[model samples]
Target: MKWESDPEDFSPSATIVPFDPPLPLLRAPMKAGLGDRPSAGSFVLAFKDAASWRSAFRATESKILEQCELAELAGFSLARQ
Candidate 1:
């Protein structure tokens, strides 16, 4: 399955690690890293079926758009500050 993340929310401290087991595995960190620092705990995603994989991709797309909106709002807020 394909994976995506929001650029605005991305942190250098975050890491995306993919593993191939009986199924495909993808993991992301829960927090951002300091410059060049490694990530800590990871959130994991496992895909065992085609339908589920497609669903995950769609969800990621929606999430990206949502994140963009949030980032825009945050930027506007910061500018006002």
Candidate 2:
């Protein structure tokens, strides 16, 4: 409950918002030879719209849970074929 503000903590209404000029990539590959290193990177955890927002959030949460479960399993020995 680290994020809990109170016993009756409630979240304010939120709507999907668009990026004004589109979020810039932290790092992108330069075209051919502009002198920059050839690298391609992206920023995850972004949603397109309301539906996308919901689905992405749920998917991320599930992935996190799955990873946690895997970590827990790592603490014990497993059967092999």
Candidate 3:
């Protein structure tokens, strides 16, 4: 997938509710091994504590639903490790 450098493209549409220990958004650099498709890329969100982790997870879940409703996404499934 193409990654946009424009901050506006990644901005959340809804106002994020403030939570304790405020979850800071982390964007990891994308990398690939030999033979990997150039279009394949991924980013990770790292949390410093459980509170931040849970807060981000819930926000992500809610965002996915909102995107689907807006036709920006077809569907999504959660896979917890």
Candidate 4:
């Protein structure tokens, strides 16, 4: 989750807006297989076609499962405290 190198005047046609085409490298390797504890939260979302990039990756996995179910129902209503 930390690969930087993409600036050099980074011209994706000066900031992507209507630039349709050039984003296809979906790597999938973090399922408890690279350092074992990081299960998710890695990121990247670029789109223009393929059905709006699969509906923007299912609306970003349904908004990260609706914000982890509203932060586990606000931490179970503050642990019923």
Candidate 5:
């Protein structure tokens, strides 16, 4: 975790609540309370262009678990928003 959102924690939540970064370059993370962290629906890492997304995914393709979309969606769903 030493992400910008939580430099202090190892597995820190990246973004703060309310102000979602714009799409394209960035995608929305799911959110909880107006003051809470991002929720599941916005769990995905969105990109401005498809190519960059594909490239990034390909780079880490081997590490990915859960082969099906359903499973993936469910995983994200259970996660905090």
Candidate 6:
């Protein structure tokens, strides 16, 4: 699994949502290790807090899983609000 755990090293895939927008976004990265076919990638989701994070996860859970073309959900994580 290619885990990009370091936020600093993830700048290329990083983006921020300004607080002026009211609900700023947080970053959640997911790795999909697709078998041994060299089909792996990262998914970046932004939210303001854990609640929003979970909401986003739920929103994408079925849609992402149904596709199942990007390997697997692998896992997801977040920083503090």
In order, the Cα lDDT scores of the candidates are: 0.65, 0.57, 0.61, 0.66, 0.58, 0.57
Candidate maximizing TM-score: 1
Using lDDT as the measure, the top candidate is 4
Task: Report how far residue 29 has shifted in candidate 3, in Å.
Answer: 13
Cα lDDT tens digits, model 6, 1-81, are 569577776575466534555554456554434542343345433454788879878879978877774444433222322
Which stretch of 10 consecutive residues in model 4 shows the poorest summed lDDT? 27-36
Per-residue CA lDDT of candidate 3, range 1-81, in tens? 468566676667544556689544544344555566656654333455788668778989999988778663333322321
RMSD of each: 22.9, 16.5, 17.8, 20.1, 18.5, 22.5
Q: What are the per-residue Cα lDDT tens digits for candidate 2 across 1-81?
A: 588656454534243455578754333333444444446323323334577667667978999999999977875545431
TM-score, predicted candidate 4 vs. hidden true structure? 0.27
Q: What lDDT, from 0 to 1, does candidate 1 have?
A: 0.65
Which digits, one per residue and each the tens of the lDDT, describe model 5 over residues 1-81? 335664545434644456668645434343344454455443454465787778768856745654566677988999956
Off by more than 4 A, model 2: 1-46, 78-81
TM-score of each: 0.37, 0.36, 0.33, 0.27, 0.23, 0.26
**lDDT score, candidate 4, position 39:** 45
- Cα misplacement distance, residue 58 of candidate 3 (Å): 0.8
Candidate 3 lDDT (Cα, 0 to 1) = 0.61
Residue-level error in angstroms, candidate 5, position 20: 29
Output the TM-score of candidate 1: 0.37
